[model samples]
Target chain A: MPKIVDHEERRAEIVAATMRVIERLGLDGATVREIAQEAGLSRSVLAHYFTNKAQILVTAHQTAFAAVRDRIAAQRAEIGDPVELLRVALEEAVPVDARRMLEANIDVAFWEFARHDPELRAIRLDSHLQAVEMWESMARDVQAAGSARDGIDVEAFGVETQLVIDGTSLQAVLFPEAMPPERQLAVVATHLRRVLRQ
Target chain B: MPKIVDHEERRAEIVAATMRVIERLGLDGATVREIAQEAGLSRSVLAHYFTNKAQILVTAHQTAFAAVRDRIAAQRAEIGDPVELLRVALEEAVPVDARRMLEANIDVAFWEFARHDPELRAIRLDSHLQAVEMWESMARDVQAAGSARDGIDVEAFGVETQLVIDGTSLQAVLFPEAMPPERQLAVVATHLRRVLRQ
Candidate 1:
């Protein structure tokens, strides 16, 4: 049988290439032709993967978010305790490398686009929802395990924790040296520990 | 002799008009002609006010930042207490109304432009410096009042506090219902109170 290319893998490759193009050239300069050239593919082939430039942008954003989601999931599994899980989730959000830098770049770009693009807007909203769900799950499990304080509002705490994560990401991106990863982790740990209650 | 226009006042008016243009149209859509139209002046007249589009964008960003600075200074004068001053600064960053909405929109738009525009990048860096100064001032006052612990790392705490403020702004802008003004204020109050070793 002839070799079959993995569609999902190919799509992700193209998406990663799109991000490289965006970071190399600002989003406005990241033209479809430029992206295709960077991806080492024909324009028709790139279009075959994503219908248009907007779709490509959207895919790149979703791809980046999926990576973040996977990182968090992996971190959650690695940390046995809920308190530590929350810590890991937050630490993951801090800007640590070029990938994270690109992620932050694409994230703010998506937010600006959300003001105008409905599809991007929907994706942005969904990503927040996913974040909320992930935190709520962790909160519930922690509460059930009696690791969290009795009578504490799990949902509210979850939202607050998410805020810290979201906020930390912005600081890390804009003021990386100012809000170092260690500092961000410490703050997250302190906040989560306090909220956990005895 | 004919009356002469106040240069500073005229410049402020032009920057204000630039903000209006930004709010109506996205950053990319705000052209020199459009800004001139919004300012109710001829293109040449607007040119006399700001040399080019980049100049107008940076000045408008600086103007928006100045409003926040003025707010902080005014609030600091009224509050006297460091924690209270910090709270007021947090409130100023939130999306309180159409005017604030205009300011926030321009603020976020500037980040994307900063990714590419050297002038905008410098303005962003300066804004970060201003934030650090604001926090450092608050920290010193707090320590002097004996509300903060002795030997407090004012610079570190200041950076963290600014992260909270900036992060809260991002969350409030992204998720208004959950991280609204009141909720944000409460979260901030809790964080501020936690950091103080009183």
Candidate 2:
């Protein structure tokens, strides 16, 4: 029998290598040659998998979002507390560990790149809308459960909470020592507690 | 009589021209040639004022920061109410207008560039510290005036406020339709009221 190739696995491997290259050299330096070398694959193989660098970048971005989404879903399933669910979701959004830090670095690059690329911009906007909706739903759920303070606008609170999370995550990446995991958690918790009733 | 040259004025002009180029074509596209064309000067003439593109970028970043600082100072002079001053300061930090939108664009580029360049990174770090200090002072002043809520940690509040400003500003740039100036101001105001005694 002939050996079967896992095309999905190969594509994932390429994306992982691309991320590593981006982390090391930034988006500007993440050339096809560099990525191929990092993946231990030839240029031809890379081409066979990805149409271009931008496609690879988009895939990488999607992958990062999916990872966070999956983590949030898993936590939501395991944790019955609405407050804990909100906390976990917010914490996962921040760059508290190596995985999240890497995601943040890629995100920074994509933000710059997306400024000019319409396709990437569309993807970013869509992803943002989805995340905001997710947060809004979660906030509503928490409020209904009586964990969040009454009379607070759930939609606005959700957006503001996300703004704080994004801002704190960016700061964490820019100033790691100043924004440690504990500090990030504290900042999120503080903001959440202030909005939510004790 | 020999024609006198104002070195500082010329440098500022070059920085302004560079910003135009950056706005038209992202940092990656804003090559030396493009900037020279945008400034209506020869490459040699451009070189006479700045060492390289990176130097010009750094100057542009500084100019953006100074513009915000000047605006805040002017507003502070005009407004006597402490709460109003704090509100205006926070509002100015968001990218509500075209000038701020341009600054936000340059900022996005600098953030990515800073990750690779230590000099740029140092400048970013220093600027952040200065802004945080400014906010902390403003928050303390407001608190002392008894307008702000008592018992709030001025330093943490200042830092968190800045984070919200930055995060909201970025979101404004990315999703202007979603986050209009009025919305941005409202979000900031909501967060401020939550932290301060209304």
Candidate 3:
């Protein structure tokens, strides 16, 4: 019998290696050779999984987003309160721990890289739209459930809420000590409370 | 007679060249040769002005910040209302024009670059603190003038305001067409009005 090749597993392994290389050497320094070395695989083997460095980067980004999405989904599965669900979902986006710190570093590098790459830019914009939609849907659901205030423009509120989360995440990554996990959560809570009905 | 050399003018010229190179070719691509070529100066001449690429990057950042500061000061000199002044100051920070777009590009690059360089990291942290302090002072002034609400935590309020501005600025730069100047200003105005007492 022929041996079974787990293509998905192999691809994920390569992406995991790519993340490690990026964290250690930034985008500029994350050369193919360095990534292969970090993965303990030959450059040719790595190339079999990814066409080039840029492909790996895009995959890395997708992997990161998927991981966060999974975590949020898992949390949502357990929560029943609409307000608490939204709060936890937003708070999960903040970089307050080791996993998030790594994600933020990769995100920062990707933003800089995306400035010149059209494909990467598209991926970024698409991801942003998805995030905005997620928040808008949540806000609408909560409002319908009477937990959130009526008369609030759900779309604008969603945009502003995303702005605060993205902004707070950036600050948290840039100044971890100044913006601890608790502080980040507090900012999100403050904004949500301000908009939610008493 | 000795040649009267304007060191500051020459440095400014090099920084301008660096910015152009950064705009055309990202931070990694804006090498010594490319910058020298862009400025119409030889490599040796460029070397005479700055020691390395890092120094040039630092100078470029300072130039960008100074330009924004000067613009804000000019606008402030003509405005009398404290609320209006605060609005104008915060609005000026947004990248609503070509010049600001270039600054944003450089800023995005610098932020990623600063992740590893301790000296650059220090500069970034210091600049952030300065921005926070400036916003805090402006918030206090506006609140004291009875334009803003009382019993509000000015420090936390200022930090949140800065977060919104910085976050919105990032989004505007990333998606200019989606987030036009008018939209950017509207978002900031909305946040300010929400916090201010009617």
Candidate 4:
């Protein structure tokens, strides 16, 4: 048997290919056959990694999600202010650029399936909860630093912040003309100020 | 060959059937043939009503949108307070229950197509523009009454209000446990208070 490292690498390759297919052709076009073609693997080999289309898609969703998280982590290294770091993360979360736009596209694709798939819903909920927790941790730092407004419900603020990210990304991805990237970034700024007063 | 009224009635019926198929089976399951079967019409008759699947889907989107608009209108008739009316309209916009859940499902299905179809994008943009105009009109009333905060950008506020609606509806529909109807309604309340103090 191959080492676990190679096993993980193969899965990552398939997930990346799934994203590419989904990105170019939308979710409906990303059939298992098409995804296998994009990944340059046989259906049998692909099946070994993922049990079904939904499983492949759930991993694809996590891939885009991880990219956003990594980008935030990279940017957060230079920023000392928790509120500023949170702002940057919120901005990174949305489809403000081609990279995040790809992520947003994958996310929208996931939402269509997550609507009906109970397992996908559970996976999405877990991811969303992690986002809330990450943001809440940063919010606590901001709160303790006395940068946030008085009586701010840090928990609600955390959840709402993620909601804004989700909502903004959906609009910006689906309706770029109406909610352009610049306007979206500006909206995030206003949202941050509303809660952080910074 | 039918009368204009009959033509419109037939189109509305087809649109309704399309939505039912879409809501039950999702956009991918919503086909020209399935929609025709759902409407109790032959595929040829469906063709006579709508030239293509995209046309039928666009009309289905309009049907769901009109439902939300009508529900808001019904409630607005009794509300003299613009802010209060806006709050109710916002609440009506999201999928707080079964009826609006159906509408939200239809909208989400439409969104999947709208992400790729230029024709659908144009139609969606037109519909969104009208919603912004309606909200701006109400925002003007709120501003005139001095119920809203000073220096509020009515145009931005109008656009952002719709963004919130889109975002909130999406989460409520896809992640109902995370964003229950009660929690969604409460978020809307906080959102409205942020915009309109009274």
Once fitted onto the true fold, the runs of candidate 2 whose alpha carbons sit more than 4 angstroms away are A1-5, A13-41, B1-5, B16-41
Question: What's the lDDT for candidate 4?
Answer: 0.80
User: Which digits, one per residue and each the tens of the lDDT, describe model 4 over residues B27-68?
Assistant: 668888898889999988888877776776777778888887
Against the reference, the lDDT scores of all candidates come to 0.73, 0.81, 0.78, 0.80
All DockQ scores: 0.43, 0.67, 0.61, 0.62
After superposition, the stretches of candidate 4 with alpha carbons farther than 4 Å from their true spots are: A12-47, A50-56, A74-78, B12-44, B50-56, B74-78
Candidate 2, position B52, lDDT:
71
Residue pairs whose backbone atoms clash in candidate 4 = none
Encode model 3's per-residue lDDT on B1-198: one tens digit a residue: 233366667777888888888877766687888888888989998888777777777877888888887887787688877788888887888888878877776676667668778799889778777777777887887888888875777888778887887788778877776678887887888777755885
Model 3 lDDT tens row, A71-105: 88898789988788888888788887877877776
lDDT of 4 by residue, A1-198 (tens): 578889989887888888888778876688888988999999998888776778867888888888888888888788998878878887887787887787887788788778778889888888889998888887888888789987777887777778888778888877888888888887788778777653
**Candidate 3 RMSD to the real structure:** 3.2
DockQ metric, candidate 4: 0.62
Off by over 4 Å in 3: A1-5, A13-42, B1-5, B16-41
Q: Cα lDDT for residue A175, model 3?
A: 75
Models ranked on TM-score = 2, 3, 4, 1
Q: Model 3 Cα displacement at B197 (Å)?
A: 0.8
lDDT of 1 by residue, B38-146 (tens): 8788998887877776676688788888888898888887986787776667667666666776677677667656766766776787798788787887878878878
Pairs of residues clashing in candidate 2: none
For model 2, residues A88-113, the per-residue Cα lDDT tens digits are 88888988888888788777767766
Arranged by DockQ with the best first, the candidates are 2, 4, 3, 1
- In candidate 1, what are the lDDT values of residues A46-138, reduced to their tens digit? 877777667766877787889989998888778788777876676676566677767776776677677667777777878887887888888
Top candidate, metric lDDT: 2
TM-score of chain A of each: 0.82, 0.86, 0.87, 0.90
